[model samples]
Target: MGRIEGKVAIVTGAASGIGAGVASRFLAEGASVLAVDRAPAPAPGTDGARFDSLQVDLAQPDAAARIANRCIERFGAIDILANNAGICDYRLLEDTDDATWDRAIAINLTAMFKLCRATAAVMKARGWGRIINTASIMAERPYPSLTAYTASKHAVAGLTKSVAIELGAHGITANYILPGAVLTGITAPLIAADPTLRETYDTMGVVNRMAMPEDIANAFLFLASDEASFITGHGLAVDGGALLKM
Candidate 1:
């Protein structure tokens, strides 16, 4: 049997990038997956035996509730919750406007808070759960021009830790994954616009190549499995040793 056979998972930002990758992996492992994203529909790697999709903006206050309800309604249970939706603003502090900052925090941090709250309730009642949030290598280190993005991701680490501490007694584990120089939907356009950036990322890590979404997805799969039951409130780095130089 698959590691998570007969289980159910809720994966946000599932239209593309790491979210889609995670959803696809979970489904392949025999889990019923609800792939959530702001896109009208998610069409990606999730061709596994059991999969579903939900379209909603994570920034919406009611979105968390809607996603939670819809997943339970369709899949019957919430075994894994992956809060992977995020937005990054490429601006220095001086160029960062209030709206840009607010949107960054709303999508990256606040929305995740609501999602954890909504999903953890059901997980608690079920007596077991795994909650994984996508943070960035920037959560601890930093780059030159992404103040808002860095701050929000930094907050993700702390928020996830707090959630883990509080939910551990209830058999729910909360952790965050820190990715570095990943080639995803968000970064693809940027790299295409500036091809030089691609080389920068490719060589940024000691492994000498930028990471693919699937590379990050594998980490989520490990954490979601029963093998990781005792692990919680930690930042799992899937960064290919990028932090070593940072």
Candidate 2:
């Protein structure tokens, strides 16, 4: 049997990138997934497994609850919740407008809060649950032109730890993953636009190469599995030591 056999998971930002990669992995491991994204339809992955998809903007107040409710309505229970939706803009701190900050925080942090809050209610009742939030190396470290992104991700890590502490008694564990540069469709254009970014990307992580989406997805799987039951309130970095660099 697969590690997640007979389980049900919710993957946000599933249309592509890490979200899609995780959803695909979950399906392969025999989990039923409700793939959520702002995209209008089910994303391409998993070799034709017919997982459900919900398109809702995570920045909206109601979107998180709605997605969680829908997952419950369809699957009757949620075993895993992966908060992976995020947006990054190329702008310095002074150049980042209020609207940008608001939008980034809303989607990257607030939405995850709402989903975790709602999902935890059910998980607590059942006495078992796994919550994984996607953070970044920037959460602890820094980089240019990612002020809003870094701040939002930093908040995600804090929220993950807080949730873990509060929900541990109820068997709901919350954690965050810090991924380095991962090769995804989104990054393709950026690299294409400036080939030099590739060199920078290689140095950003300890592995000295851009990571594949599957690399991070596998880490998510490990954290969500029973093997990690004792782990909580931690920011697990999958960044190949990128955050450790001075």
Candidate 3:
């Protein structure tokens, strides 16, 4: 039987990259998925993967409530939640304007906080849930031109931990995953613009190859499954040893 055969999951940022991989994997493992994204529904793309879709810009104040509500309306329960929607703002501290900082925090950290707040309530009522958020290698290690992104990611670690603690008594678990340099929808264009960047990222980690979306998705699958029932308030690093190099 599939690990999460009868579970229902809500996966954000489901249009592309790591989000797409997670959605596809979860479906394969027998879970019904409600995929969320602002760009589009299942674009970039899980062409044949069957799943429900919601288009909502996470930056909106009421987006979180809407997402949680939609998942319930569509699937009846939210057994797993993957707060994977985020943006990577590449700007140095000096070049980062107020708008840039605020936007990054809104998408990367604040939105997660709200969604967790909304979903956890439902999970508590049901007495079972799994919350897996996407932090970054930058969550623990900062880098040049990624000041805003780094700060927001760092906050994700603490935000998730607090949720984990608050929900443990409710048969709920919360954790975040730290992804390293991965070839994704967001990074593909960046690498395309500069072919040299391909090699640079491929070699950033000890593995000597860039991580694929599936690599991160694998971590998500584990944390969401019953296998990780005891793993709460933890930060799982799916980075290919990239943190060591950083």
lDDT of 2 by residue, 115-185 (tens): 99889888988899999999998898878999899999999999999999999999888999999898876
Number of clashes recorded per candidate: 0, 1, 0
lDDT by residue for model 1 (1-246), tens? 888888899999898889988888888888889899988445545454477788898888899999999988887889899999999878988999999999999999999999899888789999999999999999989898899999999999999999999999999899999999898988899999999999999888899999999999999999999999999999998988999989
Candidate that beats the other on TM-score, 1 or 2, i.e. the better one: 1
Error of 1 at 17 (Å): 0.8
Candidate 3's C-alpha runs over 4 A off are 43-50
51-170 in candidate 3: lDDT tens per residue? Answer: 688999999999999999998887789899999988987777899999999999999999999999899888999999999999998888888999889999999999999999999999
Give the Cα lDDT of each candidate: 0.90, 0.88, 0.90
The pairs that clash in candidate 2 are 206-240
Write out the backbone clash pairs for model 1. none
Candidate 2: list runs displaced more than 4 Å: 41-50
Ranking by lDDT: 1, 3, 2
How does each model score on TM-score? 0.96, 0.95, 0.96
All models, RMSD in angstroms: 1.4, 1.6, 2.0
CA error at residue 64 for candidate 3, angstroms: 0.8
